[model samples]
Target: MQREPYRLVHSVSSKFREMNHKIGLFGGIFQYAWNNRKVVKNEDDETIFVLVVKRYTTKHEPWNYIRPYEILRKCEK
Candidate 1:
């Protein structure tokens, strides 16, 4: 079956929009380690940003990290 192309709506940061325009979906996966550090990269094997996941009594807080897809969907609202 054919799939629709992914498009980023408005409201996303210019950085993400620029990246998405330059490269197709910043292709990469979130990598986790025992240290609670997450690394983000792009399809060209480049590091985008590094995040630290902190555990709290209520929820886990991720710092310096934004899900690639979430950025796209955010414009929907």
Candidate 2:
């Protein structure tokens, strides 16, 4: 039993401040339409990073949209 490598946490805003990147989810969900914005991959699949989803918050709650704001890092078209 040895399978633990998939980290991607970023919640910046409203004094939350949380950044952790070690992506590895196999292509990282490519893109299936999430809304706010999304695109993560770091297991050889490329796509660098990007996952902003913080539309005005009040410190937890309000449907909680997976709070993510680690934008920047996608220059390899």
Candidate 3:
């Protein structure tokens, strides 16, 4: 049987919404894949892309942090 790609939706705050937005999209999809990863092996293991949306905000100039984990938690919300 053919496997299916996962779909995930994510929302980010204005303060942390400036660069690497596509990374956020991939993170969501990866999160879904992590939740439903298969045990069996296959000839090809590839990722599929889906749709994405970004809501405009008045806030700009996002901040940066040393700890990536903290930043990821903030974005995962």
Q: Best by lDDT, which number?
A: 3
Clashes of each: 0, 0, 0
Q: What is the lDDT of candidate 1?
A: 0.37
Candidate 3 lDDT, tens digit per residue, 36-65?
665656422342111111111113233233
lDDT of each: 0.37, 0.28, 0.41
Candidates arranged by lDDT, highest first: 3, 1, 2
Q: Residue 29 in model 1: shift from native, Å?
A: 20
Off by over 4 Å in 1: 1-12, 25-77
Q: What residue runs in model 3 are displaced by over 4 Å at the alpha carbon?
A: 1-18, 41-77
Report the lDDT tens digits of candidate 1 across residue range 1-77. 49754555554567666656432322222233323444434322123232212322124323333465447535653
Q: What is the TM-score of each candidate against the true structure?
A: 0.17, 0.15, 0.29
Candidate 2 per-residue C-alpha lDDT over 1-77 given as tens digits, one digit per residue, 9 for 90 to 100: 58754443432332332222211121133232233244445333222222211222232233232333223224221
Q: Candidate 3, residue 12: CA error in Å?
A: 19
Best by TM-score: 3
